[model samples]
Target: MPSSSTQRNPWRYLRDADVLHAAVVTLLAVVLSAGIVWLGYVVHVWRIARRAPTTLRGRWVVLVFGRQLVADAPGADYRGRLARALALLREKTAGRVLLLGGRSGGARSEAEAGHAWLQGQGLPADAHVELEQESVDSLENLRHARGLLQGGDRAEVLPPVALLTSRYHLARCLLLARRLGFDGHAVAAEEGLPRTPRYLALLLMEATYLMWIDLGMRWARLIGHRRMAARIS
Candidate 1:
């Protein structure tokens, strides 16, 4: 049986109050940290959006990122992006185009499908067009494209690049392009479908991806610095 003194102890109450206060402070700290991270992410996205170039000029290569095709045909989003790319290709006569995407849901790769579509659209025979069908994602697309550009005769002179993607995806594409060391601009295509819950979900997913990439790059730099320091020491 517990004593009444023990049950009514003011010191016990004080101790519990202290613990509750500490817990609340810790929770608040975590929330504040999360808020700060979220704010930073928003600012990063905003900056990328602001920096997305409106005009593409010079000896630029149009990089059309691939989307999933159904029944070997480009879906509405992909069609919209392809249409924009076609328009750009027609307008920018001197600029070449590169279709970037991987095989999905069929034997034909996205890049291959894009090229075929453009040919079907009666693109000029002399227009410089390239296909990078091996990439699995946006990062891989840029990396592979860089390799293609820097390989062989073009190694000495890498041309500037312009990305054509959906409006929501353009910022992340530009971010990836910059990380891959390309003088890049972005041309955002109009969203083919109306804004739905899926669109918001995709935007959130992109934001998460951007955060992941930023963290990965920072980690790589830190690791590289440590390795260099170790070698020097």
Candidate 2:
């Protein structure tokens, strides 16, 4: 009589080397596909920055923030590009700029830097360049800037505003702008530095911060909505 002890277990066979190799390959494929999709989305956002609207009407304000101007300085190529873009905007909008941001180093605030840049370009003192000197990040920049604008009589009477930031940042910035009750368009400054290790590091940091800023914006909107509803009721 033949013993049945030699019968192979089906479960054990499934865990063999070839089967394991197949499973690993399948997982790698899925991961690679997901990476591709994410990259495509990033590219699309870049395009949005490059092609934002350039016009503002009688009732809207043109807001420009991020990276202060310095056309010639150390590790300041992005600031230079943004400055040039803002200069062009000033020409187009005829001095309707609402600059945001504060100092990066402990020396100055983002709003102060922005003010200095526009003033250097000969923007009048009354040219509508609002500042949020206390804001250290994008979320604070936008939130605080919006509050400053809304607190003014002109903002109450004018139409919604248009926000401008670097092109790659347009996606998240636009999201925050809208969430904060800005019923206006967002323009990408479309500025960049040469793709180098340092530049890439800056880009990565900016992207990571965008995610955190979005979280802050979510909470801001939730609270804003509740307050509005409470007032109505």
Q: What is the C-alpha lDDT of each candidate?
A: 0.67, 0.52
Residue 190 in model 1: shift from native, Å?
A: 1.7
Least well predicted 10-residue stretch by lDDT in candidate 2 = 1-10
Candidate 1 residue-wise lDDT, 121-172, digit = tens? 8787677888887766677788888888888453466678788887668778
Residue pairs in candidate 2 whose N, alpha carbon or C atoms collide under 3 angstroms:
59-159, 101-110, 101-111, 102-109, 102-110, 102-111, 103-108, 103-109, 103-110
Stretch of 10 with least lDDT, candidate 1: 1-10
Q: Count the backbone clashes (under 3 Å) in each candidate.
A: 0, 9
Which residue pairs in candidate 1 collide?
none
TM-score for all models, in order of appearance:
0.72, 0.58
Q: Which is the leading candidate under TM-score?
A: 1
> lDDT per residue, candidate 2, 27-90, as tens digits?
4543778755334444555455556654444444666665543432212433543464455555
What shift in Å separates residue 134 of candidate 2 from its native position after superposition? 0.8
Q: What is the lDDT of residue 199 in candidate 1?
A: 68
Model 1 lDDT, residue 160, Cα? 80
